[model samples]
Target: MTKPSSTDRPNPLQVACSSCNLRELCLPVGFSGSELERLDGMVATRRSVKRGDALFRSGDAFEAVYAVRTGFFKTQVSSEDGRDQVTGFQMAGELLGLDGIVSDHHTCDAVALEDSQVCVIPYAELEALSREFGELQRQFHKIMSREIVRDQGVMLLLGSMRAEERLAAFLLNLTQRLQARGFSPTSLVLRMTREEIGTYLGLKLETVSRCFSRFQEDGVLEVKLKHIRILDLAALRKMVNSPC
Candidate 1:
């Protein structure tokens, strides 16, 4: 875990209707007036977590579903020796607790890589509101569908792709996801450590480090400690498609 930075302070209350970036992503499409108010009312609070902060642990009692307002995070599982293996990375506007929606116990641990803010919506309240409104139910279904698709994509990345390609694909996916949430797609501040990234991609820490060097050499990206900027996304796309 890295040391805390200045932007890692806790978040204040969030009213979705007032946030332009959240209008479409958090609220249902064409949601207006009273419907939006009902949706907004479900948000219990907004909280901030610094890099290296844990949102919840595996097997913890699940109380709320967090919708990321900004920044990135990872969902991880622990091995028998208590080492973490990252299962997924989440961009802004993505829901982080869907896997536990039915189980009521977290399926994995979620940790913020960057100083991030997430809207904590009580699951019970959301369920109650969703039951009464067909539109809300439809919207909830769509969100779940997206989450499922994203998970499938990750499975493909991890199960089939080569080491460097897996790493590149992960970066490309992260950029696009963040871009949808109104963040820069080309330049990003990495939140995950090299070791953490290796765990997520099923690569060795040294291989992950060498892959960064290869990217820099190939003019695909530049990495300096914490900051990463994708210099040639097209090149990266090609690398991700390259045969091992």
Candidate 2:
């Protein structure tokens, strides 16, 4: 078997270094050299998360917004039955917990689905930085816009898409997402559990299992336990883009 190629991620930012992928979206892209330096100094710390680890639980006190340095995570809210209802998934270079800043507390739990790193930037400090850096405010707005767009996409996907269509589209979305973060999209290990997936998709566990088997039997995808190989992306796209 061929081993995956390793990528040399540049040395992490001491304070918003050019090496950071999120600098473009998380910080002012057009900051004057001096302004950028000052803004960087306010950033305090970063934390690493392993698969199945919770970055913050629902109702945790909000301190700073977390920017993904690597890997993927999911956000979930507890349902009345004591089970979690998955609400969001984030990838490398994305921001998590931005919404919590407004309320001063977390509304959902943020859990890592794979080994991940996060850079925490204090909201109170950012308010001060935004005054000195006009572009920093713009970057904040850009991130907000992306959040709105993603939420809308999920609503549309869940309400209108068929079960099989939803499953394939979800895989395709995950594949393209991982690819953007420098991972192989075609054959990769599943990070999130099947139960998490079903909760996110609004499907029963048995239904999700059956959909996987049907996709495999029909040669659209190959599934062996948790590892998946997408054999027919074109067909999957057709399903996702199909008119319901």
Candidate 3:
């Protein structure tokens, strides 16, 4: 990907973590002004990715971890049979590129599900800053732990959950994350397509569509193409928590 032009960069003061609205979600809590400035300095640039483009691909050198300043992304890895398997979806205020920390190269492709911008935090500089700030180090560790936990949850979804249950859990997770970012808990426009959701949830495209229809028939959701409104949140939660 080409570097963003100098003119496209946001003013440092504007993008500084100290004043960023996402600071509470993206940064460790209770950092002093000085610490926030230092952390902000680690993010020296912002990159814009257009819809349908990849921010990073498998085998690319990992130089930094990106913070999604806006929009959404999906990370996927190719299977042995050459099919792309969607691993996870990431949204604004979330971090990406952690997959490369152990190997120094990205193992999956991070593609924009919509037009997106990310704060580029150079990993080396971030490491230095984290060393000086104990809270930053702890927060970084917590982020990694969360990724692990999410992966385990995906495993459970694929291994045992029925198609309806898998889709219900996926919607619940997506809505919860969006709600954390101040979005309505019941309404959303899905950034990824039904096919992509099927790929992520390990369901066939037709099966995914059928499950949506079933949910609508059962008064659980109001579906209008990409727009989804949960008409019965309690029913979805019940489906997810139902005995296997």
- Please report how far candidate 1 places residue 218 from its true position, in Å: 1.8
Q: Which of the two, 1 or 3, has more lDDT?
A: 3
Worst 10 residues of 3 by lDDT: 4-13
- For candidate 1, the 10 contiguous residues with the lowest summed lDDT are 5-14
TM-score of each: 0.86, 0.84, 0.94
lDDT at residue 14 of model 1 (Cα atoms): 52
Worst 10 residues of 2 by lDDT: 3-12
lDDT of 3 at 198: 99
The lDDT for every candidate, in the order shown, is 0.80, 0.78, 0.90
Q: Write the per-residue lDDT of candidate 3 for residues 1-244, one digit (tens) a residue.
A: 4876432556455667877788878854567888788887787788888898899999999999999988899999997799989999999889999999989999999999998988888899889989988989999999999899999999999999999999999999999999999999999999989999999999988999999999999999999999999999999999999944
lDDT digits (tens) for residues 214-244 of candidate 1: 9888888888976889999988888777765
Which residue pairs does candidate 3 place in steric collision?
none
**Candidate 1 whole-model C-alpha lDDT, 0 to 1:** 0.80
Residue lDDT tens for model 2, 125-150: 87787776677877788778878998
Best by lDDT: 3
Model 2 TM-score relative to the real fold: 0.84
The alpha-carbon deviation from the true structure for residue 21 of candidate 3, after best TM-score superposition, in angstroms, is 0.6
Model 1 residue pairs with clashes: none
